[model samples]
Target chain A: MQHKQTVIDIRNLSYSYVNEETSNRVSVLHDVSFSVSECEFVSIVGPSGCGKSTILKLIAKLLDNNHRNIGIDRSKMSFVFQDFALFPWLNVRENIGFGLKMKSLDKKSLDIVVNEKILEVGLSGSEHKYPHELSGGMKQRVGIARALAMSPSILLMDEPFSSLDMLTAEKLRIDLLNIWTKYKMTVVMVTHLIDEAVEMSDRVIVFGPRPTIVKKVCEISLPRPRDKRSKEYFDLCDLISKEIL
Target chain B: MSRIILGFHLTKKRKHIFTTSFVLISIAVIFSYIIIISGDNAGQLINSLMLSLFRLVSAYAISLVVATIVAIFISNSRFGDMMIPIFDLLQNIPSFALIPLFIYWFGYTNIMTIIFAATSILWPILFYVLHSLKTVRRELDDAAKIFGAVGIKRVLYFLMPVAFPSLVTGSIVGFSIGWEAIIGVEIIGLASGIGQFLNTPVGNNNNQILGISALLIIVFLINRLIWMPLLRKSQLYAA
Candidate 1:
């Protein structure tokens, strides 16, 4: 996948939040350089609060103008937050269509896309239900639907599956991989789970400590639908562990 | 003991049907006496009912509008922090203390009375709405942001519905306060209205207060009879 046309181009990006009423600065990321090729699936693993979320926030452009030191080109990016972040007031149908509505996609096409997605995600019957009426898994499904509906070229996710139980997380990882293959969209996800990155992603990048930098980028050569109990699975996890702790 | 149980059952069954055997008999006795020594009976009845409804609608409409705007501002902005101190200072000033100022400003017009009543009562409603909007889930806000809402306009579309129950509760409390204020304000300065009509019977020999009491009953009954069911239905989907 060398020189495969990178969708994201990070160049010595560093970020720090201001200390209010003072000149002090809190550094989150530093000299963080990485890129994803078209249709590549990459996962970022880091210790908690090590600027993993800050990277996604920058990509979403939900950062302050003063935080430009933590540089990002927020446009041309779509983010999936750690919390499911579903609008409780909106029904599943409206929530899924919300992004397309914002970007002003044509009404007729938007409806068609929303309908197609509702069925594709196995959420066809519960279209009219609000967020509170759904289970945690269902809420996350809606979140995924919302992000994918944007059809963004680069998708950024921040620990999207941290809330679910082991079984649900395992199943969603497979579903996510299938979705990734189908859409051929570049994805960069953050997680603390090494097994998840090994099972779902094509490449793994690790970030650590304040003033975070990319520690390693290991290519995952596993075949599709990779099972965790297999020998290769344990080896990849071990390799990631060695780099992490 | 059996008779007491029977009367309790009657009271329960006739909640709005007005069975109350003893009260109805007392009313009948008063009416018989009124007929024997009456002065313009029908005129007073009509006047009291009309005044109450007029004042109630006017004061409530004003309170609803003002309370909603204030609530939105308080909940959606950092300025909302100032609300508590402002309200506490205003509450301590006493509800009727501003009556003289109102009369001087508006010169005994209907608007004067409505304004006075609304000012005295809108705080509870505004606070309720602010509280409701503030308590909406953080996740809902993040969802709204991901959809590209950047500023004040987002509160209208994303936040208003999420705080529906609190809006209703706050509005109702405000309306009730407005209703009470209207009667008192009218009693003090206004020459026409239900409060004036009720006062006339107090000064004379008639059961005119019954009509005014009936109007009060209607306010509470109407709220439960009309809005409660709607609220319950909306809550089903909101959750």
Candidate 2:
């Protein structure tokens, strides 16, 4: 809401997978522009095949740029990949401590922060097992911990928990809200689950089909520890649902 | 507790390995006994086996070093593109066919023989490493970049572990190929290895070099019995 504190400013941001001359080109995002405030927890939801993932990839700098030029202020950016891309070689502690270790964390503080995140993500007592050893939910929890440990200026997650069962996803959604509240870390997550965006996001931005555009942005003023069963919450969910389905 | 005793998959005791090797030695001793009863030619077969083992070890070691260094060079520079097709061409040239040319150049020396053997074997290791570097998954690279792994350490951390399975795989193939190779180098070129010793009387009036041919079979047996198992277990770990 405050222009002065804006962390991201995207103007005339357009992307197409094919060259301009090609009539067959699919323009994924057209004239897409938006500003994210500092520590903003923004969720982008779209229909199944929309380019919501592509927007996250663009934010994370993983997208291949054929011609569209992307411009963003030079602040640290990190992504928690869609499928929990934990280094299979490392165990939980090493994986959580990875970004910190990369930036060269001092040994004592690294151990403390790593231990804290392990406990934070509810992944306690499993630091020695590699990613291959962990369950799917546990692996995603490891992914969340690793991203949080980086202490990045912003976080971009592409469908981070879509693969998990409903119960685990619901639990993680609560944990995600808690982490966002505590850290005030800016986050942009992609999800097809309607209630997920409504329950956790300050603002939910929906992407459109094929030639993707920001179809909608709904501001949420719901109270903390959101009640999904509440009439207002379900209303917001249903309203957002029709846009996708 | 029972699993602790023998480990995950130990069907036999440590004593079994010693006993097996002992039985093998006993079989060799019995044959030597027959040789001694028949006399002289039996002695040549024993000498030939020892010589072949030494030559194979020396050639393999040299080949491994050459391959690793060449692979490292290809991985880091523009020369990599050219080296691949060159190596492919070389892979077609049989190790034995090179012997006559090697003798003309390096001239009837062990150096010429070892070089010929090494040229035949180096391709697999070089190609394996080079291809591994080229084929690392994009997500893994992204993971590494996020971790701030850059430069040589990046390759060491991300690339090497991913490449390790291929590296070990290629080395095993190369080692197997090198075994059959030493015989060609030894017999065709000049000097002393089991192949030369076998070639000796097989070419002459005496039929005892036929006995020396037993050395080739012994080498084959040793490769399968000793080296192949070790390589297989290591490959399992690498995989």
Candidate 3:
């Protein structure tokens, strides 16, 4: 296999959360090490409370990392939260425009970029609408639009489609794949759905129960427009599910 | 193009008109009283009413600035650990109890009156902000962090908006306290204000009725114009 450039490198990464009331520390991720290649679509799959989401946060630099060996090589990174995390106070356009404003982009350029991302995410007509007015799928689209507006080299998503219905989630996953192919950005998604992990990712990193350890790393060699009904796809799904279990 | 871009789905036009009319009526009445007093027709009643309202507003503004900064500090620092307990105890003390200390220090002047009203208004606003900070959703904080929102940027874009609903409610409560406290402070201090107007209603003076009418009008206008609009905005934003 050709050596792809490493975009993310984690070695002996451990995290513990402190209880404010009891003053006790509980370890979440322990000595977990993994690397993601540049422009790769990767998914972290595990059972609940397995620190799969924590790993995404660690990569996004949203969490305090006392562990010395974690390295994210990307210059720009953005996150799409599991809950959609759209600001209820802001309209869709403003929500998408927030990171650009944070970066101090001038108004004219910010508007141009926001409008482009809004169209890319298929939320053009809903720009003036608040998050409360949006459906589950639309809200996640706005979340994706907000993350993409920053034009980040790496996009971290925490179960972006988990909150939507099966039909909506399927549609969003396909849309995301198409967008990813065009944008060619590194994606690190955390999800519990084995089928989703197998279908969307170039590689799947399966995590064990807390304190988490990297249990398995599975690669999917399935071609584009992947057929979930295929025998190979089913077998791969089974393999990933077994690894998660 | 600018109108379309800045389109805010605000309250209904009719509702805004109604609130505006209510405020305008209060202002008209207050102005009429002021005119009458200046002409020696109402005789000190309008001055007293205006004086009380002025003291309350100034003190209320001070309390707002003080409470917001203190609330932010307490929520964001180790200072919070010490300050919160102190507040917990301070809130237990009746705000009116501070009147004696102020009178001794400032000699029953406007300064004493303003400080008294500020102390009365401060606690509710501070506690409301603290509570709002405590209840802020984890997802929003993470989102803000990922976007590189820090310091004043975080406060302006994230904390203030998140705390807004509670903060507005606290301000309304604070206004109510200041309204009553300013009058009481004036009455106790025997200072020149609406409380004095209420105290001295000589027969056939008609200052009594005017004072009472002006007092009610001011309260009604403040609720209609300021608190109601803010409350509506908060609800819509929270939605």
Candidate 4:
């Protein structure tokens, strides 16, 4: 097998939040390090409040990096938020084209790109609907479409489907995996669901409770079209779940 | 079927236009009758009212610009932490109390009246926008930055739209207070305006009633025509 080049590298990344009232530092991630290879789908799994999302933020530089040794092309990254943070005032088309517009893409190309993304995400015929008018599933589709509109080299998702119902989440998970396969872009997701981590990602990076550090990096060697009922799938899920528990 | 739907829309639109025209014509007839009945005082009342309207509008415009700039400047900054309390303290000081100082400086001039009115109008808008910007959701802010909305782009695309609904509400509150401030300053110090017109010794009760009625009409028209439409439109900005 050919060795894929590392697209994202982080070494000894530490982060803390300062409590305003007491001026005390609360540690979130301590000496956490992981690297993602090109076109790899990786999920960071941990217990609640275990700083899994913080790791994504640190990678995206949404929070201050504080001179930490993190490496990635910031401009080549796009984020899909957990809450589907589509601009409320803008409709689906405008929401998807947001990053493209920010890049000052001309109207013709912007429309073309936006239209293609809308279709790809199965949001056809809802082009003019606002975020408030969308269901949780549809909203996440918009969020994913928005991220894809950037044609990013790396997609960072922070609990993209956690807000949806299980059925919607399941459908969306499959759709997202299809998109990941089609685009062949590196995707780093923060999710709490062990089965989801096993079902979708090429590798699962399990995190311990705060201050979070890497507990395990389990490679999912399951072949394409993975069956959730298969013993191998269940065993992989249990193996990853045990690290968090 | 499309033609029928279009025809229905046309009929609804026609009915709206007809109702609006009828109301406007009725107002014009009543206004003309008042002018004729009031005789020469009509011209004086009209002039004073126009002056007061101009002063109020100028003050409101200035307040809107200044409030937006100030709120955007201090929001999410440590400086905001210090200055917000100071601003709160300043807003609490009776706006009318500052009229004496304005009068001493500008000497009952239009500039003084406008400046005085602006003091009253600025606080509500500034505080409202500040609160809106400060309370924006963390994920939205992150998404904005992640999507390359930084610096002026952030202000124009992200911050401004986020603050829009609050800005409209603040402007409505600010405009109401502005009317009071403009009228009070005019009544206290200025030589001309509807406030001065009302304050002047009239020959009879009828003219005083006419002046008050005109003021009420102008205020009502402004609220109905401008602020109401804007308030309705601002609903679109709500997240």
Query: In angstroms, how far off is B27's CA in candidate 2?
Result: 9.7
In candidate 3, what are the lDDT values of residues A1-245, reduced to their tens digit? 88789888899999998978999998999999999888899999999999998888777777887635778854588899999888889999999999888888999999999989988989878989989999999999999999999898889899999999999999999999999999899999999899998899999998999999999999888998899999999999988888777
Candidate 4, residues A33-151: lDDT per residue as tens digits? 88999999999999999999888988898888675579888778999999998899899999999999899999999999999999999999999998889999999999999999999
Supply DockQ values for each candidate.
0.34, 0.38, 0.70, 0.84
CAPRI grade, predicted model 2: acceptable
Q: Candidate 2 — what's its lDDT?
A: 0.74
Which stretches in model 3 have alpha-carbon errors above 4 Å?
A20-24, B1-43, B201-208
Please give each candidate's TM-score.
0.82, 0.78, 0.92, 0.95
- Give the alpha carbon lDDT tens digit for every residue of A1-245 in model 1: 46677667677788888878896888888888887787899999987789887777666666653444433344556667677887666789988998887777899999998988787676888999988889877878888888888777778888999998888877777787888888888898989999889988999998877779898888999888787799999998998898888
| Model 1 CAPRI rating | acceptable
User: In lDDT terms, which candidate is top?
Assistant: 4
Second chain alone, TM-score for each candidate: 0.73, 0.71, 0.84, 0.91
Question: What lDDT does model 3 reach?
Answer: 0.86
The best candidate by DockQ is 4
Candidate 3's DockQ = 0.70
**B73-133: candidate 3 lDDT, tens digit per residue:** 8898867777888898988898778888888899978988998899889999999999888
- Clashing residue pairs, backbone N/CA/C < 3 A, model 3: none
Question: Which ranking of candidates, highest lDDT first?
Answer: 4, 3, 1, 2
Error of 4 at B201 (Å): 2.9
Q: Write the per-residue lDDT of candidate 2 for residues B47-148, one digit (tens) a residue.
A: 766776666667777877776667666776777787788788878876676677878899877677667777766778778877877676666677777667
The 10-residue segment of model 3 chain B with minimum total lDDT is: B4-13
Residue pairs clashing in model 1 are: A14-A70, A15-A70, B51-B194
